[model samples]
Target: MKKLALYLGLVILMFLTSCSSSKKMSSVMKTYEVETMGVGNDGTYLIKVTDYFRTSDEMVYLDGLKRDAVHCVIYSGIPAGNGSINQPALMNADTKIEGYEQALNEFFEQKEYLNFINSVVNSSKTITRLKDSKEYRISAVISVNKDELRKYLIDKKIIKSLDFIF
Candidate 1:
């Protein structure tokens, strides 16, 4: 009778230990919140994609075609109180948009965060071009699997329709 009781106690202990370990298993899902805005063909969009990381302290940029990673999360697009859309441009000229090529070069320097952000589809630079008496700002942040993105573009038929005008 004592031996049977000991075996039962051991079984109970193992069950409790298994339950505790199961509770400690972590979650596997990731989520990214993306937002985009376009104005006057010169407006810029700020996209924030947060995964398991809770803080928005860093952002990663990748060249659209080359797919190289860039570090520095300088432009998180956290809204400035109840300000207007042009708030990003309200800063000093030094803080304003750099020429496309210059911005591209600077962005390429931050390659350390690439593995975390696999690819970026839209251009990273805050580009300003005049069109029809209006200036447009175009920028984006994309957080997703690189392979999934290319496949998505192809599946949606958007990839086949565009020709590089640049």
Candidate 2:
């Protein structure tokens, strides 16, 4: 009986913690909303992705051993009024676009954040760019292809045709 009570209490505490964390995140985001300049000619969009992580995690990632941090994947596709659009941009681009190489420089030339990481996909070429400010202690590399994004967008009606040419 005592064990059962303890288990219930733990579950309740976990539920409340998760709920409060989400609410706290909302408030933090309100204060630090992403700044979007606009989309590029090839449907590539630029926005700063920010997250509010636990202070402990922030200290570890921002001050510890994470020097060359990889980046996270795209969270949502582009948006239009009254609805969402499949205006997806791949993180990996095989064709480099002018005025877009700034991301690479930006990636290397930034610091003094809770945590900052910029991803570059310049092996073949690149048309998309992204920089992330995470409040969590997570590491990853997200590779994507334009063809795959197009197929998914078309199949899901995010775009009209594969060559819709955003």
Candidate 3:
């Protein structure tokens, strides 16, 4: 009986802690919600993807570059109005876009910007399209590895290397 009571108290404390932390964090960061729509050959291997950025951030362009509000995309082939028979693809941010590498490097390299996106990405939920058969309809906030993200951006030349000389 004592053990059971102790375990229940611990569980309640953990639950309250998590709920409060999430609420507090949400209040601190500006929220950006993304709903993805994608097209490609057969919708199996997406050739083009559209990430709709829903945020309070000003979507503007300055200094000859795009505003950091949302990301623009480029596609390998024209959307055939419907998926092709090529093969099915997963609905992920894996498609290659025009100038995306450069944009990603410029945008996510900054600590503040990275943190902003990190918060957004980790907090925002993933929605799916019913028309796409392979869609997973996963609607949950997920966290990511910053180191892996940085390395991927660097490898794709979206950002500069950290190597420096005195």
Candidate 4:
């Protein structure tokens, strides 16, 4: 009877552990929110992105935020807000393109996205600590060269050229 009870307790403990791990994984995979802050001169878009991360390092935090902003612009359109019109995503998320994932992985892993970022307004950075968690919610406004990024993608054949529809 004692052995059976011990086994049952062990099973419950394992279940609880699994549940917590899954929660952590889900949070890590969660998407950050991006909104349009304004438009910049010379085909640039000013966007605000909010993201949560466990690290408190400023450089790491800023890098993640910048990457998220570019990701949102390419895959998830920046929502219309703060006197800016809605900007549609450059690549259709629903569309499946062969080699696109490989190209995207290389683009980010190689930090190629940095080329399109005009600047990150350090003065606009905001950080908020989450209650009962080590995670911090950080937000920043960044200027991205939209036209240049689009042209780059087209050149890499990751996205179709504007003249393709002609």
Q: Which predicted model would earn the best TM-score?
A: 4
Question: Model 2, poorest ten-residue lDDT window?
Answer: 26-35
Q: Write candidate 2's Cα lDDT for 35-54 as tens digits.
A: 23334324233333332334
TM-score quality measure for candidate 4: 0.79
Q: Which structure among the candidates has the greatest lDDT? A: 4
The sequence of per-residue lDDT tens digits that candidate 4 reaches over residues 1-166 is 9999999999999999998886433123546988788778878889888999898799998889888888888877778888888988899844335678788888988999989899999899999999999999999999988899888888888888767556
TM-score of each candidate structure, all chains considered together: 0.20, 0.24, 0.23, 0.79
Which pairs in model 1 have colliding backbones?
41-136, 42-136, 42-137, 43-136, 43-137, 70-110, 71-110
Candidate 3: tens digits of C-alpha lDDT, residues 40-71: 22212222222333221323111101112222
As for TM-score, the candidate ahead, 2 or 4, is 4
- Candidate 1 residue lDDT tens string, 45-147: 2333322222222242123312221112222232332232433311122333334334334334543224335435444534344455343333445443334
Clash number for candidate 2: 3
Question: In model 3, what are the clashing residue pairs, if there are any?
Answer: 42-84, 44-88, 44-89, 74-98, 105-158
What TM-score number comes out for model 1?
0.20
Q: What's the CA error at residue 12 for candidate 4, in Å?
A: 18
Off by more than 4 A, model 3: 23-47, 51-166
The C-alpha local distance difference test score for the whole of candidate 4 amounts to: 0.84
**Overall local distance difference test of candidate 3:** 0.34
